[model samples]
Each structure stands twice: as structure tokens, then as C-alpha cells.
Target: MVELSGKSDPFQHSFPNAVFYIPALIVVSAVAFFGYKLYKSLTEKDRKREEKLKAKQAKKKK
Candidate 1:
């Protein structure tokens, strides 16, 4: 491995802002996706419960 001279440190390289923004964007997207999935699951359970109640009420009227 070639060593960089006196003032030049390998770790001192400048990274563009996009490098940092990319990971942040990915994390935000993943969180949003998971949140949506959880919301949909809860709503589905509620819908099923409502259907059962409606069916039971209809049977009582017969």
C-alpha cells in the first residue's frame, strides 16, 4: 500500500453530501414502509371484526 506523504491523510478525504444523505433517505423510506404495513394490518383486523358483528346482528333479526 502506498503511503500518502506528510500532510495528506487517507482519512481526510472529503465525501460529498449525497453520501450521507443516501443512507438517511434509505432509513426514512424503510421506516415509512414498515409503518404503512402495520397500519394496514390493524385496519384489516378491525374490518374483520366489524363483519362478524354485522353477521351476528343479521342472524338475530331472522
Candidate 2:
């Protein structure tokens, strides 16, 4: 490999290019986890509501 005197890269000693990778990955994963949890909670509430409505209807029919 041809080495340039002032060239910067991820493995270069002068500048750290890959430094932001880990923090960015962590932030994205955190957001995804919270989003998934919110979705699951919302769906669960809907499911419970539907179950209650069905039970109520059954009681009315009886």
C-alpha cells in the first residue's frame, strides 16, 4: 500500500474515523428497542379491549 504523508483513514494514527460507529449503533438500537416495546404495549391493550368487548357481548346474549 502506498502511504501518503498526511492521509487520514480509520487505521490512521492522526484521525480516528471509526470512533462514531459504536455510539451511533447504540443510539439506533436503543430507539429500536423502545419503539418495539411501545408497539407491543399498544397491541396488547387493543387485544385486551377486544377480549373484554367479546365477553361483554357474550354476557348480553345469555
User: What C-alpha lDDT values do all the predictions have?
Assistant: 0.85, 0.82
C-alpha RMSD for every candidate: 5.6, 5.4
lDDT of 2 at 29: 100
In model 2, the runs with Cα more than 4 Å from the true position are 1-13
TM match of model 2 to true structure: 0.74
lDDT digits (tens) for residues 1-62 of candidate 2: 33434555656444354566778999999999999999999999999999999999999999
Q: Tens-digit lDDT track for model 1 on 8-54?
A: 55564455778778899999999999999999999999999999999
Q: TM-score of the candidate numbered 1? A: 0.78
Candidate 1, residue 53: lDDT: 100
For candidate 2, give the lDDT of residue 28. 96
Candidate that would win on lDDT: 1
